[model samples]
Structures are given as structure tokens and as C-alpha cells.
Target: MDVTVVGAGPVGLVLAAELALSGAAVQVLERRADPDEAMKAQSINVPTAEALDRRGLLPAAEQVQRELLERVGSFAGAADDRPPGAGRPAPERRFTGHFAGMVLSPDLVDWSDPDLAAHAAVDGARMVPQPQLEALLADHIARLGVPVRRGVEVTALEDTGDGVRVDTTAGTVRTGWLVGCDGGHSTVRRLAGIDFPGTDPELTGYQAVVDIADPEKLAGGWTWSTRGAYRYGPQPGRVATLEFDGPPAGLPHARLRSRGGTPMAPVTLEEVQTSLRRISGADVTLTALRAAPTRWTDNTRQAAAYRSGRVLLAGDAAHVHPPFGGQGLNLGVGDAMNLGWKLGAVVAGWAPEGLLDTYDAERRPLGAWVLDWTRAQIGVLRGDAKSAALREVVADLLSTRDGTTYAVKKISGVTQRIDLPGDHPLVGRFVPDVWLRDGSRLVDHGHDGGFLLLDRTPDGAFARLAAAWAGRVSSVSDDHATPTGVLVRPDGVVAWASDTTDIAAITGLEAALHRWTGAQTSSPAHEPVS
Candidate 1:
């Protein structure tokens, strides 16, 4: 096998599908008999969608649902004028207005840009159930003719210098590479001796998907407090969640569904029902419920190395943090997408082993930032005096267009620009969608799994470099002079740029390629004439 993926969950499945699509012979091993129950993580962020769009998987994921705007249930703003007859008897208000909570906007790169639109459409995040996502990814992998071994567990792994020898419950298999997409408590991480140092689960939240006759009437965000215990939920539909500080004795482990393993007692549906009734005046019937332990961690820990010889780690196996901004699944899928092309390239013998090292360098810092921001959010939810003050200040600042725009950028992940310093606008920024005069778009540059140069003019340097690299690089030059020429990496970051006709003024294209791709080619002595 070209690659062996552990744990056939959504992350593993997506990674397998991506690798298989890249034309790699992939095999997936799972401990579970089949897909498990849908528990958490239903919302996909804008960056996640953009990442999927680059791989052409967004459409299939979007088949389930479209973008979901954040809703505010009961928090009100300070309007100058009060409601009519405020002095008299007033109607009871359960919650306030819609503009209270945070809003994550769409990606910065517009879909209308012809070059980018054709390559990838900028669809906002989709809200699909986790189980559905897993099933779809698994089906996509099967369609690609990749072998998926269910009900099999990887017992041991031994690096054979050339490849990895995997021992599983079903049978023994050999592969050039291994990726662990397994969730927290990951067996792969343990086998690899990776340490997951992070904060303990101080807060526990209860989530339930219940059938409500008047779901529409109960829609919006909610934050209710009872005896200092906070339960916030009813995020715009029938799904209601209750989050509270864990009891001093700790929560009793109760299995709400078969998906989450069995645990100790003290937790039950009756207790959840009582809590819901106390929180909300309505007597809501319970359909399904599960408890999720939220932990605060660095979110930056990797295997010290992504590849220990031939074994690698991706998704939850690589990093774990609170699911605060709906980033866990997205982060995992991103890990898959980033590794898929490189794994394919290495397997095909185009890229050297050193290319894999970039994964940790680029992604670890980004992961740490995400963790820091999410921890700040958790602090706000915990009602820390400083965090509360900060929220108030932020809310006041958000009254302005610029402030709101900044807030949106921060939460949406569009602001996450990779630091690749150069003259080109596209470098360090996501490749913006370009509207070609011919009316075609070029969003899926990663389809071929190589570096792409979008030259606005007839720059011979880019063409020459592409010709020299052959199958290892791709270059496209449009007749029209777009604002700037963009160089996109296999993972979709703009690696190089040439804003003007002076393509030779900057470092040679060969040097840029070698730097970005970790290629060992000699740098061209003379810059080609534009």
C-alpha cells in the first residue's frame, strides 16, 4: 500500500479519500464495525470549506447543506428608546436580540475572480452532521477503488526504513507511509510515543438532538444561569445543549449513546431533563443527549516530527483542543489535505523526504494561535471579570463597520495569512479568485498536486521553469494583465509573487521553487527575459 490510515472516522476517511484521489494506493483500518452515531461538530467554517473547495470535495459536502449564520438568542443591545408602554405591564422576554454573539464571515477571496472561481468556488461553511460527513467521505473513498478494512484495528507498527510494517487485528500489511487520523485517545499517537500535554477537562457540556413541535419558535442563541451554573444553547433550531461546570465529585460517566464508550454512573437522561426544565421554562422532551468534556490544550503539539521515518500523524491524532470555534474537524481535514499531496509526491519520487518537515513548521504555529484564541473565547464564556469587560468593550467597538469587519476577519479564519514575504500581493495570502476574460476559473490548482504559477503576462521565466520541472510543476499564463502573478503551493498558499513585468527583479523562479518545494535543483544563473 502507498499509505495506511488508522481509524476510519471522518478525519481518516477524508484523508484516505484525498490521498486516493491523488492516485495513491491507500488502505484504511478501523476499530469500529461501522460509522458511529452523530454526536458533535456539525458546523464547518469558511476556511474549512475553502480547503475542501481546493480539492473539489466541497460540492459533495455541500450536497448536505449550505452556510449557517450565527444566531443570538436573548442578549439585547442598548437602544436609546425603550419599547412602548415600558412604564406599564410588559410582555415577558426569554432572550434578547440577534446581534449579541460573534459572527464568522466568509473567506476573503471572492468566488467571482475568474482564475480562482474556476479552480475553487468560495462557498461558505456547510452544516452537515458528522456521521453524514464520514459516510460521504467513505463512499467517495470506495468509489475511488481504495480498500477500506472495517472492524480491524492496528495492533502494532514497525518502521522498516523503506516502509512501515503494520500489524492489525485482521491481518498484517506493509505501506510506504502511515497517517493516524484517529480521535483523542488516539492509539497511533500512543504507539508513536507522542505526548499530548494539555489542560484537563474543567468544563463539561451536554448536547442533545430532540424533536420539538415548535422548534422555529425556540430558535436562536441562549445563555441561561441557574445557581451560578451556566447552560447555553438552542443554537437556532431543535438542537439544544446545556453546559455547566462539572460537579466537585466529577460527572458520573453515563453512556447516552453507543458511539461514546460506556462510563461510570451519576449521569442520566432524567438528570438532563430536570436541568433543561430548570434552564428553560418549557418542558422539552429528550430525544438524544451526549456529554462532551471540553479540554484546554496547546493544540500545537505534533509528533515532535510529522514523519518518524515512514509513519506520520494527521487530524486529532496530531493535535487536540476544545471544539470552541468548530475548528477540530476542519483542522483535521486540513491536515489530511496538506499531507495528501506531499505523500503522493513522495510516493511518486518527485519530492525529497525533507518536504514533509514543512508540515510541522507551517501548521504548528497556526495551531497554537488557534488554541490561544479559543482559550480566550473559553475565558469569556467562563465569565472571567476581565473577559467580560473585554466582551463589553468588543461589543461596543463592533458598533462600527470597521470594528465589525475586523471581528469577522478574526473569527472567520480568512485573516490567517501565511508569512511568505515578497513583493507579490498573492504571496502569504490565499490565492484570490480571478475572473478570466474567457470566463473560466482556476480554483482547483491543487488537483495536480504541484506548484502553480498564474502569470498575468508572457513571462518566459515561469514557462521555462515549468518546462524544466516537467511533471513536478505547472504554469499557466493568461493573455490579459491581471493585477499580479500568483504562485500557489500544493497546500494552496501563495508561495511566490511578481507584481509587475519585472519578473527578473525578484529572486529567480527556480530558486523560489526549490525553496518552496524543497527541491534540490541548481538555481538558474540568468533570469529569463519577460
Candidate 2:
């Protein structure tokens, strides 16, 4: 096989699809026998939604079939139901989620910036649950003709110079590359001897849905108490509680010390009620526990390197943090999008020497940023007088136009800039969703998993480069106001663009093609340029 992706989660599936799109043979190994139905992650942020859209993997609005959270959810402030602008008739602005349990109101956010707004074609964040999202992604993978082998756990890996030997529960397989998307307790990462270093757990968190005996006592939504915080569902049978009382008490006996000396434990209904009572100080009782209660800690950790020889890591294998902003799934999806095409290039024997390394260089820092972001949130969620006061101050700031804009930009992943070397303002920034003269969106071409050259006036040189690159690079003739030409990578980041299609422009385009896709040494299989 060309590539073996461990863990058939969203990230693994996405990477497998992108690799297949780039003509790489892919096989996914997942330990789970069946798909998970729990609502692990409930939303796809704007940037992640765009990433799915670019790949044509985003399900239709009607197909999502879930509640549309037009406004972002936050724990920072109380929920607002006034439609952001108090029933005003203007650009609809919704809350942009929250930071530190405070809601960042949409009324305070400025969506007036044309450049930023250009990246906002989708309605808003979609509230698709984990199972539904997985089903949508599984459909996409099925269409790609890739097989995701379930119930196969990766046991060991041996890097044999040209390829990696992966030993799984079912059998052994050899591939040119192996990616560990198996999550935080990644076996591939462990076998590769990669160091996962970060902060230890400070608090234990619990999430579950249950039949509450006394639902009237506990109010819907968030409640901050001296012990901790708890949020009840809008209706009965949903509850989440958090307590700062160290690792959860009464862990099932099957845990204490697992492999690698890390602690492991199973959460029970009794413990859930205990935590809830301690945090909320309410005599809330559970009639029946519906789903398994998930117990996690604020134990943050990240792999020191994303790659180890022929083995690599993405998703939870790469980093783990508190699921404060629902950034975990989105971060993994982004990593897949970023690594897919680049790794595909290398496998096809045309990638630049350092192309694979860029995955770590570009994504590791973002991982660090998210870690710090969650850490900061935990600082405010300390459930102390000082933390409460600080959270109030943040909530006040988030009630302003400037504060809302800044928080929205950061939380939405729209302004998460990549550090690429270029002179154009668009370089290393989110590609604007510009409208082509043909009435098609710029993101439309990105589905093919190839570089895009939006050249207004294409000549023989541009045509020749496109021909030489063939399926690797695609060129489109369009008249756009921002620039005469734009070169976008497969992941939708603009690499090179020029104001005119002169000889210098052509030279720049050629250099950029080489820089991003590596040198096209094959003889030109010329395709006519429009």
C-alpha cells in the first residue's frame, strides 16, 4: 500500500480521502469494531467547515439534519436568545462561541471587514454531531473506493528505510508511510518512540446524558459555583459536570496504571452524581444513565515532533488538550488537510526535499497556541473569586465591538495565519472566497487536490508549466479584482499571485510551482490553456 492510516476517526478518514484524491493508495486501520454514536464533538467551526467544503466533503444543510447553532456557544457568558441584534434587520451576527465560560456576543463583533467577510460564505458553524459527521465522511470515503479496516489495532511499527512495517491485530502490512490518527493514546506514536510532553491534569471533567429525577431544580445551561461548573441540557436527560477535585474519585478497578505509566479509569454514574453535587451544590439525582459517561482531565500533551522517519502523527496523536472550544476535532481535520496533499506529493516522487517537514513546522506552533488557549481558559475556570472576577472582566470586554471581533477571529480559526514567505497580503492567510467571472466560487476548484493558478491572461509559458505539471497543477482563466493571477495550494492557501502575466510573472509562477510542488521533471503532456 502507498499509505496506512491508523485510527479511522475523522482525521484518518479525511487524510485517506485526500490521499486518494491525489491518486495515492490508502488503507485505514481502526481499532473500534463499530462506529461511535455519542455526541463527542457537536460542531464544525467556520474554518473547518470551509476545509470540508473545499474538499466537497461537507454535507448539505438539509443532510446535516441537526439543530443549526447560528450563534457560537460559549461558557464565558449567559446564553442570549435575542438574535444577536435585538431583532434588528441588518447583517445577522450571532455569538462566536466562548472563551473562559464567557459568551462572545455577535452584536459586539464587527463582520464589516470585507477581506475577513469574504471567507464567510457558509451560513455559520454547523451543529453536526460526531456520528453524523462520521457518516458523512464515511460516505465520501466510500465514493473514493478506499477501505477502512475496523477492529484492527496497531501493535507495533518498524521503519525499514524505504517503508514502515505496521503490525496490527489482524495482520502485518507494509506501506511507504504510516500516520497515527488513533488519538491521544496512539500506539503508533508509542512504537515510534516519540515524546509526548505537556502539562499534567489539574481537574477532572465529566459528560453524560441521563434521566434526571429532579430536572426542575437544575436550571438549563451553565451554572458556576464555588466548587466548579455544571451545565444542564435544554431538556431532560442531558448533563455535563466539571469539578476541580483532582482526578475523579471512585475510578473503576480496571484502571490505576496502564501502559506507559499513564493513569486510566472508567467513569460511573455514582461518580458523575457526586461530581455534579459537589460542583453545583444541588441534590440532583439521576434516574438512569443513558450513555457512557466520558471522564477526561486537563492533562495537556503534544508530540515533540509530528514525524519520526516514515511514521507521522495527526489529530489526537499529535496533540491533546481540554475540549474547551471544540477545537480538537477541527485541529485534527486541519492537520489532515495540510498534510494530505504534501505527503501525496512526496509519495508521487515529485515533492521538494523539505515538503514533508513543513507539516510539523506549520502545524506544531498552532498546536502550542491551542494548548495555551485552553490553559488560559482553565485559568479563568478555576472556580475561585479571582478567577470569577477575571471572567467577568473578560465577559465585559467581549461585550464590545473590538473585543468581539478579536475573539471571533481567534476562536473561529479564520485569522490563524500560517507563516509562509511571500510579499502579497493574502500569502499565508486564509484564501478569500472570491467570485470568478464564471459565477463559480474560487474554492470550487480546490476539490481536485491540485494546485490552482487563476491566471487572467494565460500564454505559452504558463500553459507549458501547467502541461508539464499535468494533473499536479490546474490553471483557470478568470478576471478578479484583487490580483490578475493567484496560485493557490491544494489546502487553499495562496502561494504566488501577480498583478500582470508578464515574463517575470511567469518566472515567479514557475518558481512557486517548484517551491510548492517540487520540480516537474516529466516531459510536458500539454493541455491547451484557454
Candidate 3:
């Protein structure tokens, strides 16, 4: 096979689909026999929504969002407004997520900011939990004819120069490339000897669905207390708490088994009850456990290198951080989006030299930034008086137009820039959904998952120039876009852009094309591996 993706979660599945879309023979191996029903991320960020939209999968995901809204109603209104069992009836305003434990108000955000304005094309967050998102992606890959094998664990990995040998519980797979999308305790990462280095944990967190004996006593939404922090219903029976005692099981992140599920062994009801009582200081009791509880920590870590020889890592295997801002899921999704097409290009034999290396160079910095972002929240969230004062100052700042805009920009990732070579401001940023003269938006043409050359010039010289890389890129004329012409990679990043088609600009476009698309080949330089 061209690529063997470990961990059949959202990241692996997305990478597999992109690989298959780029004409690579790919397969997925997951350790779980079935999808975990635990409530994971409640929403997806800007780039993730656009990634789904470009793949023609956003409608399906929006349907999932709609179904979710129909079930729970819109997540609107303030936490204190609802008494226990107060029936959260809302078509009210949306919440913009939280910093530390402080809830962000959508109204406070600066919608007029260019970053948020452009991101409005994709609009606000989509409320779909982790399991539903995974299901949606799994179905997409299924339609793409990618095989996903569950109950298969990666036991070992050997990168023998030419390819990778992956040993799994189910069997062995030999492929040109291997990606570890497995969770925090990734076997593939371990076997590959990739060093996962980062800060240690300072807090232990818990999320569970349970029957509370005194539900009315607990507060709604996220709450920071003198003890620690706790979040109660927007959903009945949903409970989460953080205690700054130490890491759950008092172990490092590497020693932990997975994202959740009571950590290594099953946590008892007594443990949760004790935690809730301590954190809330209200004597609230969890009467019955409805589902398996999961333990998390502020244990942040990232793989020292994304690629080591023929083996690569993505998603949780590549990095781990506190689940602040719901960034963990979106960060993993971004990794898949950024890495997928590049890896696929290499496997399809049209990628220029050092193209694969760019994955680590680009994503590792972003991963580090995310870790710090989460850590910043941790800094505001300790039970000490100083942290409380810090949280107040941060919250006050977040209430401002500029502060909220900056936060929104970081959270949405709409106008995020990579360090690509170019002087054009649009270069290294995600191309906006520009309209084409053909009456279709940019996303309409991206369904094929190839690079796009948007030439708005009257004579379409750039389009003609782009035709040389026909098999790898599609040239379209757009009358509405700002840039005279723009080259977008399969992942939607702008590789080249020009406002004036001067000789120098045109020459630069050609260089960008050659660097990204590899030699103007009429067809894939190599056939798909079986």
C-alpha cells in the first residue's frame, strides 16, 4: 500500500481520504472495535469547517449539526439564568467558548475584523460531538473506498529506508508511508522511538455522564472555584471537574493509556463524588455512573519530529495538550488537512524534493503555539488568589473589541499564515472562497481535491500557464477575487498570488508552480501503488 494510517479516529480517517483522493492506496488501522460514544468536542473551528466544505462533506456535517440543534435547541443564554432542571430553552445568542473558565460572549467579539469577517463565510462553530464527527468522516472514507480495520493495534514499526513495516494486532502492513494518529499513548510513536517532549501536568480533570443525587445544587456551564473548576449541564447528566491535586493516577501523560476511559483502570463512583464535593464545596453527589468516566490532564507534549524516515505522525500521536478552547480536535484535523495532500503528492510521485519535510516545519510550530495557548489558560485557572486576579484581568481584556478579535483570530484560524516563500500577503494563508466567472465559488471546484489556479486576469494568461501542470492543478478564471491570479494547493493554502502580472510576477508564479506541483507533468509521474 502507499500509506498505512494507524488509529481510525478522525485524523487518520481524514488523512486516508485525502490520500485516496490524491490516488494513493491507503488503509486505516484502529485499536477500538467500535467508535467511542463519549462526548468529545462540541464544535469545530473555522478551518475545519472549511476543510469539510471543500471536500463536499460540510453539508452532511451541517446536517449533523442541525440534528443536534433540533435535539438540544441552540446553545444560547447565560449559565446563571437557568436554575437546575430549568429547561434551557434558547434561540438566543451563541457562546464564543472560554478562556480558562471564563465564558466568552459572541456579542463581545469584533465581527468587523477582517479575519473574523472572512471567516464568516464559513460562519460560527458547528456543534457536533467527537463521535458524530468521526462517524461522518468514517462514512466519507468508506465512500472513497478506503478500508478501515478496527480492533487492530500497532505493535511495532520499522522504517527500512524504502518503506515502513507496520506490525499490528490484526496483522502486518507494508506501505510507502505510515502515520500514527493513535491517541496520547501511541504505540506507533513509541515503537518508532520519537521523543515526545513537553511540560508536565499540574492538574487532573474528569468528564463523565452520571446521575447526580443533588443535581440542583451544581452550577451550570464552566465554573472556577477556590477548590478548582467544574462544569455542569447544558446537557443533563453531563459533568466535568478539574482538581489541581496532581495528574490523574499521579502519572505522566506518556504513562497514561488514552484520552479518557478512567485512565488506566476504572475509576470508582466514590472518586468522582469526592472530587465534585471538593471542587464545588457544595456536597454534590454523583449517584450512579451512566457511562465510563474519562480522566485528562494539563499534560502537554509534542513529538520532537513529525517525520523520522518513512514513518510520520499526526493528530494526538503527534501532540497532546489540555482540551481548552476545544482546540485539540481542530488542531488534529488541521494536521490531517496540512499533511494529507503533501503526503499524497509524494506517494503519487509529483511532489518536489523537501515537500514532505515541510509538514514538520509548518505543523510543529503551530502545535507548539497551541500548547502555549492551552497553558495560558492553565495559568489563569489555578485555585490561588493570584490566579483568580489574573483570570479577572484576562476576562476584562477579553471583553474588549481588539482583545476579542485577536482571540477570535487565533481560535478560528481563518487567516492563519504559514511561512511559505512569497512576498504576497495572500501567500502562506488559506485562500478565501473567491467567486469564479463560471458562477461557482472556489470551493465548488475543489471537490476534486487538486490544486487550483484562480486567474482573474482578462485574457487568462495565468490559467493558460497553469495548464502545464494539468493533472495536478485545475485552472479557473474568477472575475471577483482581489488577486490577479492565485495558486491554491490541495489543502487550500495559497502557494502563489499576484496582483499584477508583471514579468517578475509571472516568473515567480512559474517558480511556485514548479516548486509545489513538480515539473508540469501531464499525469502523475508514478502510478498508484496497489
Candidate 4:
């Protein structure tokens, strides 16, 4: 096998598919015979959409047939009072001070680059069912001809000198690398002996998805009645979800059981319907029920090393946490995307092994940042006096353009700026969507498999840099002149950049390249800027 991916969930399937698309022979081992039945993650953010789009999977994701509601309104206390639809005059807002945050529907946001902006607009989140998403990705992987070995478990893994030997229930297999896209409890992570250090939330959450006749009544986006403690969302068609803070005893009688169920009275569809009626004052009829236990763990842990020789961890295998900010699935997909290109390059022999180390360095901090912010948001949702006070400030800030921008950036993941600092604008920041001097959009580089150098000047040093890397790097010159040149990683991040075409002015280009490619290559000789 070119790559062995453990687990066939959305993350695993997506990773295998991405690697397959990049021409790597991949195999995915999953214990389940098919996809999971329950709907887990229901949202995708801008960065995630952009990542999927790069692999031409955005259209498939959209084809899952989910629609977004235009607005999200929050409530404080349960009220039986019913207001008219959006067309009618507004009723007195009962939870004026209790409202936490509003998530705008995705339709209102621009998604010109369907992949780039998949979750770009509509309050930094898009509502999509996890089952539907997984099914769609599974279909894509099948279409790509990647083998998904369902009902097979990876029993053991041994790192061979040159590659990895994977022992699955299906039999023994050999691969240049192995990726752990398995969920929070990943066998691959364990096999690699990676330590996952993080804190589990003291609180537990219960969610039930049911088929309701009047889901549309609850369909104006999700409403948080008890801050983060309790929430509800209406899915397209007749599906609706009710989630609440778990009791001290835990769900279906404590002891922290699996979604499969425990000894206590099983959570039934009638219970879900009854809970909905009690909370929302709507007598909803339930057709089906899916119950699960959830926790808000802020464990900001990543693998001590993303890769140990031939085995690598991606997605939940790398990090695990609560889904407070809808970052769980998105973060996993990001890990897949970040590792996909590098793995592709190495397999194709375009780059050396050292490039893989940057995956941990670059992504670990991002995981930590996400964990911190999500924890803060969860704290806000705890609904204590401090949280209430903070919500008021946040709500007020959300009303202004700047506040909206900040909130949107935070939620949508557009604000992720890498900590690579230098004088260049692209340094320590995400490469912005800029027009090249040649009138081509930076987003249209059309090379997703290798490093791209964007220089405005037709100079020798720039050419020399590309020449030194040869097939590993591709050079693109902007006909219109600018002083600086930018080098973008395969994942669309700026790795090395400069403000002047003198090439010599770009002091750290070589060092940056070596750091990015993980190759012990010599840096381009350049004079230090005084």
C-alpha cells in the first residue's frame, strides 16, 4: 500500500481520497461494515470548505442536499408564546439580554470559490449532517478507486526501516506511510505510541435527533436556550435535534457508555419529542431517535510527534476536543489537507523526508489556539454571571462592523495566521487573495501538488532558487512588476517571501524552503538587510 489509513469515517475517507487523487495508492481500514448511522458534526467552516474544494470535493459536499437557514436567534427562558413567521411584524424580543450569538445562513455569504469559501459566509458555519457528509466522501473515494476495507481492524503496526508494515484483520499489508484518521480513540495512535494529553469536560451533553412533523417551526437556525448547556437545531425536511446538559448520573444511567447504549432505560423517540415540547413549547411528533453522549473536553493535545518514521496521525488521532466552535471535523479535515500534499510530494520523490516535520510544528500550535478559543467560548456558554457579562459584551461587539468581522473571522477560521515572521506581508500570515502582475488571480495557480514561487521580476536569483529545487518547485512570474516574491506551500500557505526582486534581499528563502520541505538543502546566498 502507498498509504494505510485507519478508520473510514469522514476524516479517514477524505484523507485517503485526497492521497488517491494525488496519485498515491491508499487503503482505509475501518471496523464498521459501513458508515456510522448517527449524525455527529453538522457544520463546516470556511477553511474546511476551501480545503475540500482544492481536492475537487466541494461540489460533492454541496450535493449532499442540505440548505442553510437565513438567521439564528437565541432564547433565554422557555416561552410558550408563538410569533409569526419572518414576514410578519416582529414580536417583542423576550430574550434580548439572554441571546448569546447569531449564526447567519450560508446563502448570504459569497462562495465564488466553492471549495475556498464552502463555509465562508453565514456566520462562519454551514449546517450539514455528518452521515450525509461521510456518505458523500465515501462515494467520492470509491469513485476515485481507492480501496476502503470495511469491517477490518488494524491489529498492529510495525515501522519497517524503509516503510511500515500494517497488520489488519484483513491480513498483512505494506505501505510507505500510514495515516491515523480514526476518531478520538484511534488504534493507529496507540500503535504509534503517541501520547494524547488533554482534559475531559466535567460536564456531559446529550443529543437526540428525531424525525418531527413541524421541524420547520424550529428551522430558523439553532437556538441556545441555556447558553451552551442546551441547544436545538432543525435539519432540512422533518429532522430536528435537541441537546441538553447531561444530568450528574449521565445518560441512559451513567458509567460513560458508548453510543451503542448501556443498561439504563434507553433514550427513545418519545422521550426526545417530549423533551422538545417541554423546552420549545411545540408538540413535536417523533418518527426516529438517535441518542449519544457528548462532552466538552478542551484537551488541546496533539501527538508528541505528528509522524514517527512511517506512521502519521491526522484528525482526531492527532487532537481531540469538544465541538463547541464546530472545529472538530474541520480541524481533522485540515490535518488531512496539510499532510496530503507533503505525503504526495515525498511519495513522488519531488521532496525529501524532512518536509513532514513541519506538519507538527505548523499544525500543533493551530490546534492549541483552537482549543484555547473554543474553551473560552465554552466558558462563555457556561452561563454564569461572568459568562453572561462576557456574552453581553460579545453581543454588543457583534452588532458593529468590526465586531462582526472579528466574530466571523474567529468562527470561520479565516483569521488563522501562521507564526512565520519576516518583513514580507505573506510571512507570519496567510497568503491573501491577491492579483498577480500578470492579471491572474493568486487562487488560480493550478498547481496543488508542489511548491509555487510567485515573483514579479524575471531575475536570476529567483530562477536560481527554482533551478536548485528543480522538479520540487515550480516558478510563476507576474508580468507586471512588484518588488517582492512569494512562495506558497502546497497547502496554500506562504512559506518564504520577500519584498524586493533583488533575490539577495530575501535573506531566509533557503532556510524557509529547507524548513518547509524538510530537506537539508543549502539556502540561497543573500545579503542581510541592514
* Top-TM-score candidate index: 3
Q: What value of lDDT does candidate 4 attain over all alpha carbons? A: 0.60
Candidate 4, residue 372: lDDT: 75
Question: Tens-digit lDDT track for model 3 on 1-530?
Answer: 99998888788888999999999999988777887665466778878888888898866876665555544543333233333233322324233566786766677777767766665545523566777889899899999999988877777778999999888777878888888888788878888899989889888887787898888898788887777899986666778889987786646554244542223665678888888889888978778988767777888999999988888889888998988767888889889998999998888877753788999998888899899999999988988888889988998999886887677678777767899999998899888767666667777788879998888877777877777788788888767447888899888889999988667767788889888888766543333212
lDDT of 4 by residue, 139-243 (tens): 888888988887787788899879998887788988889888876667788888988776554444445555556654553544445523334553322233333
Q: What Cα-based lDDT does every candidate model obtain?
A: 0.58, 0.75, 0.79, 0.60
Model 1: per-residue Cα lDDT over 315-391, one tens digit each: 76776655655576777776776777777777767678777877776677766776566566556554446656776
TM-score per candidate: 0.78, 0.89, 0.91, 0.75
How accurate locally is residue 524 in candidate 2, as Cα lDDT from 0 to 100? 56
Error of 3 at 249 (Å): 3.5
lDDT: worst 10-residue window of model 2: 252-261
Residue 418, model 4: Cα distance from true site in angstroms? 2.3
Better of 1 and 2 by lDDT: 2
Residue 421 in model 1: shift from native, Å? 5.4
Give each prediction's root-mean-square deviation over alpha carbons: 8.4, 4.7, 5.3, 7.6
The residue pairs that clash in candidate 3, if any, are none
Candidate 2, residue 391: lDDT:
86
lDDT of 3 at 126: 59
| Model 1 RMSD vs true structure | 8.4
True-vs-predicted CA distance for residue 88, candidate 2, Å: 16
